[model samples]
Target: MVQHFNFFYDESEHSRKINHSTIVSENYYDNFITTIVGWQTADEKIVLKKYLDFEEKYSDRKSDGELKSTTLKKRQFKNGFASLNRDNIEFILDLFSIFDDNVLLYFSITSKIEYIINQLFLNYKNNIWEDMDMMRYSIVKAIVMYQPEEIISGMYENTGELVQLLKTFFNKRINVNKTNPKLKEHETLAFTQILILLDDINVKFDINWNYDIAFHGFKKYLIEKDISKYSLFLDREGDDGNTLKAAKQVGLTFVTEVDSKEITGIRMADMLVGIISKLLKSLHEELRYDSIEDGLNKKILGEGWFNLNEQQLFLYKQLTHIICEVNNAWYKSFCGIYSDDFIILVSLLNYISSFDTVNEIKAVDKKMHGEHFNAYVCKELESYFGRMESKLPIDPIPGGKKDYFYNQRGAKVFFNSSKQPLLKINEGCNIFNVLSVGFSNDGNAMITISENKNFLCYRLPKELFEWAMTCVAFANRGDNVFPSKVQFTKNGDRYYADVL
Candidate 1:
């Protein structure tokens, strides 16, 4: 007979419209931090006693028999953990003490805007992360940094409008750069990435996408942890009809819904999730977890933790230590960020854990990386199109129209002709595989250069590739031609070709 462990799950967040302007996910309330506290059947009594003893101590203050993270008065939390009275603080520490080798705890964070972006970009078909994901993640971050508004609005509208809005934005940006030249590198990257991913699919963003990441993490943990069988008892508030279903996806034989206020285990989960959500929200607003060697407490103290109280320091160190202890089993645990703030959160958690994280995360960056990333294409796109990648070019900046603004709209924005020699993907009978760089067919400044079948105009640096593609595309936009899907496999190498 297969033995079963037990899990009590709880969540701390509400459904809200995603705030597009926010960069850091934890800083906003639109996101969620859901937690799972689990243990085997043999230790069930040990688990109940912890909550039992604590409830007995606080019986007079509440008599409710449930310990909530909000046990501290709302205004009191302004002082951090110091806000909790000594007796209640011990209650929290005791609950956390149960999070050991046997008792399991995991935290999952999801951002609303990040969810929408992932959904808008990661449609079932035309998904960019299938095989080659080298630039997919970095590409999304670049988009978020440069065109958060365009993408955000698209989620509320047609997903295809995402493409049109981005085009207008980048077209405007590229035109403006010709004058002022302040376009950031990521903006250029985001431009190319958008163009590359412009598909006909009209996938609409759903509110449900917000819960997918956190739930997916939950499912994966239940599915993979120790290859063990388990029964899940989710908090009543967690029964949004999705959490229970999400947990079931892992094939858990026994998943029942119960009130957290009634069950000791779920109440512990509620308490832990409550504290964790507050911890993340506070830290995100107050600090950046950049240090690799120091615990959160030590790092804060080292950085002149003048705003913090002594009890806050002690409590954080204690809690952070318990959280990091979970990292030891993080492989099956997946106890980290899974949403828009993934890079920042993983880096932060690796930075957040007070103990050595060498064993915690093996390839955090390459977690979602598939075999799809085509380095050659990334390179060619950069070298051929990376305009003004170096120093700001001020020479021969295009001047405003000599004609009146009343005659034409805004100086005709972009030029139909190129003063500078332009490059084109060679589609010739005799020329074969070569990039036609500079000049025209009249051969004034034109030169034919050898090109690869896979990669574009030689190799460009990965960082600059996206930037260059945007430049090349915009530069050649007047021709009304854009490079569509460049797919090659069965026959031989089909190089760069344009679509009308």
Candidate 2:
């Protein structure tokens, strides 16, 4: 049997990068990283077991009740991961050890500044200013670098007002001022040209620019991965209306949003992204953290942070030593650093490649390292995700077949909302994630019928839902109260679910 893939995606944002550029007065840019950790579905159980075991054994027993990388103090690693206290350092190594040879990684780093500048100029590609993409970028770069601070503080709310602001600012700059200390002489003309060009266009501002481009980048990576069948579970607070449509374009067989708290894979992704982002930062600059705190921001580098035991002290180094060979399918790495100011990316990759284990960083050199460093990774990702596979399981419905399915021997149910019955049948490893009791769509509640694929809703008629859930007594119970193993089977056009 051909094995499919399961991917868990997690994303995080760090402090804005302060660029000492010759362009803007306040050159602050937001840094965002999205990590997709993938493994063969066949090995999903094994990979998940590793995370669970480590969390049980090594979690710091913090009151937050999560063994998350976010909880790890930065001051603990104020010097580097090497300085992380023993307990957390052990967590890091043991956490990653879950992958074995079955895991794959695709990470992309982008910035809001890059997203705005490139997208702003993308429209002018066929216009007279098309050839001057960089000049156009520089013109807008200096203006939006501070982002809703200087010129665009309230411009986003109303485009007409935005245009007026731009018109007022650019008219003065072009006719009266004739020069900006930030922008060069020719860029001044470029700025004036952009303002005039905006008049012909709708001039829309995309609030979801970063996420849209990030998904596009992810889509590109998955396509290059050449995997025919795959399921993606992402941990996010809300839904991206167009993301589902966009993700389907990449031939995803299954996709769903999972709570990181419950999904081991998402939790692992959270840790992976957290560590890698800081790892990159550590590689780029010397640590100058504030004095350690009560794990707040000071006294931050305490014994509990990274003061690891002698045996586990090598774990941090173990991370740096992991082989990043280009041919290694076990871990395919991609870096989508926006190119214009890719020096930081290059310097980090330069250091990564210095170790024979980091061939992954070099993969971006040609794409992100051209002279002006202006080729954005979004384009590279967009180009890579060009082809689609023919004749495959397009979107496999969970448990669509007629068969008797049994939940795990001991399963737990959890609730997300207090107002209504929105049940999550977390069979330990997230087997049956559906079962809504209060839903009254067409005189029925919703119950997901599936084992390990996209959720397929099986609307239980009010009669059956009431009868079955009463046997289960799901309504009155609190979170994680259900501990019975239930069996579900489809008979003809009707479905039968029994609480066994």
Candidate 3:
């Protein structure tokens, strides 16, 4: 019988404070990390023994004999790992080298607060923007559904207080502007209440989101390598086991829980978890974060975010390389073979890369170096357009506009709402309805129609083109379906699409 590959999984978290909070206040971002370690069952004994030897050499906990990531800090070397700073680094590097030799590693990180805020504000829920029907239930579900069990149970225990707070938060009008003091205070308190109510929702979202991504990555590896069966081991503590159900939902067949003390693979995961947590913090600190936090007024990552010392840079390169390499490998296996949905992602990423100059690059480099290295990692790690920032500049490609109205400047044009972006290509096709919806990428959302050919483009902002990709029809041979009629309309910040 062929021996199956066994996988071990673990998670880590880092909470970074973005704003000053007193004892009474609470506002910060919780970044979540999940790492998966996998190896063949035949190597289990060797892997476990290697873990034990490494623990014996570095760990100070004799009774527990399990290496905890929290104790692996550089400053805690005296009482924890019992090695010099450089030695501790080398120890982890050596351990990761072992992992590289024997096991496949993958991780998913999410900044919890960022996701929460985006779901709350930029999404249609705030109602400051468009009143699209799809957004109606989304706000309620995003808030109510993802509550942590503890928060839900606690609310049940104090139903009266919870009800009153909910009533207060809902009844108050949320003013977008801050010129009026009373309205501003009301909005401020309302937001604070919402945050308090959803205190644990962030963690729950983080767990689900990160778990789903990590499992997907692992599954992709299995499929690409043609491995049919594998056993999964998750640390039996906390929410680590919470994702087992999710794994099953995603077609994972075998999973079991193992205590960190009993399994060396999980111990290795524990170390990587901690190391990654630290690296996240160091990476954030290395950047000119003020511009990232405030605005892009100053040069982004110009002061050398990726310009790192040798050791620090090596670790950064190694970890990011592992993620991108693993993901890109999976992407390559199917994207070129089957023309996957990720073809859009490739197009978008290529579009972003086109913006690179002599000094800046948008995507994370495979080696985690080169121009704008810091910007690349930051974009990879953060939400697509979270509260911290807006969409990057996407300048229009000028040659596409052959008609006169498509070249119109500074005019408001609206179209009937449609489902997907309208794409048409032909020689000398320059006759149709022309409406300038809005300016994006310094170009209007213009519509052009010709005899039996309708090309509708530029409805939403360029950032939204990503969401419209799946709906886009690529004009190719064999079978062609083009929208006969399309409409694009913008109501405040919301853009709508309809097709007929």
Off by over 4 Å in 1: 16-30, 60-65, 72-91, 123-154, 157-160, 167-192, 199-215, 238-240, 286-311, 332-500
TM-score, per-candidate, Cα-based: 0.54, 0.50, 0.46
Q: What is the lDDT of residue 468 in candidate 2?
A: 49
The top-ranked prediction according to TM-score is 1
The sequence of per-residue lDDT tens digits that candidate 1 reaches over residues 1-500 is 55578888787765534443343343345346777787878888887786678767666655365567667444444434645666757666666666667677767765544555556556432222331132334434334434345555665655556657756765655454444334245544554555565544345656454344555655555533543577778776533566666666655557888887788888777777777666455434343323211111211212222222444445555666666655444332332212333222233333323323323223333322111112322344355234312222112222244321111111111232234223433334223232322222222332233344332222222332343454344434322122333211221333322221
What would the per-residue lDDT of candidate 2 be over residues 204-276, giving only the tens digit for each residue? 6553343444466556555445565788987756565344454556555488877777788888888877876
Q: By descending TM-score, how would the candidates be arranged?
A: 1, 2, 3
> Where does candidate 2 have its weakest 10-residue lDDT segment?
387-396
Tell me the whole-model lDDT of each prediction, alpha carbons only: 0.48, 0.49, 0.44
Query: How many angstroms is residue 460 displaced in model 1 relative to the true structure, after the best TM-score fit?
Result: 35
Writing each residue's lDDT as its tens digit, candidate 3 over 1-500 gives: 55588878887653322222311133112455677777788877887787778777775644455567766563432211212357655765666655545666655555443343343333232222322222222223223323333323333344434434443433332332244545246334544455444433322111113245346556665655546668888888666455676677677888887788887778777777676555444333323224212211222223233322345335434544444453344322211111111222222233233432423432345244433433554454334223212211122222222322232333222333243244332233223343323233334333333333443443444544643442322211111133344454555555555544
Best candidate, lDDT-wise?
Answer: 2
Q: Per model, how many backbone clashes are there?
A: 10, 17, 11
Residue 323, model 3: Cα distance from true site in angstroms: 3.9
Q: Rank the candidates by lDDT, best first.
A: 2, 1, 3
The CA lDDT at 208 in model 1 is 53
Better candidate by TM-score, 2 or 3: 2
Tell me how far the alpha carbon of residue 247 in candidate 1 is from the true structure, in angstroms, after superposition. 2.6
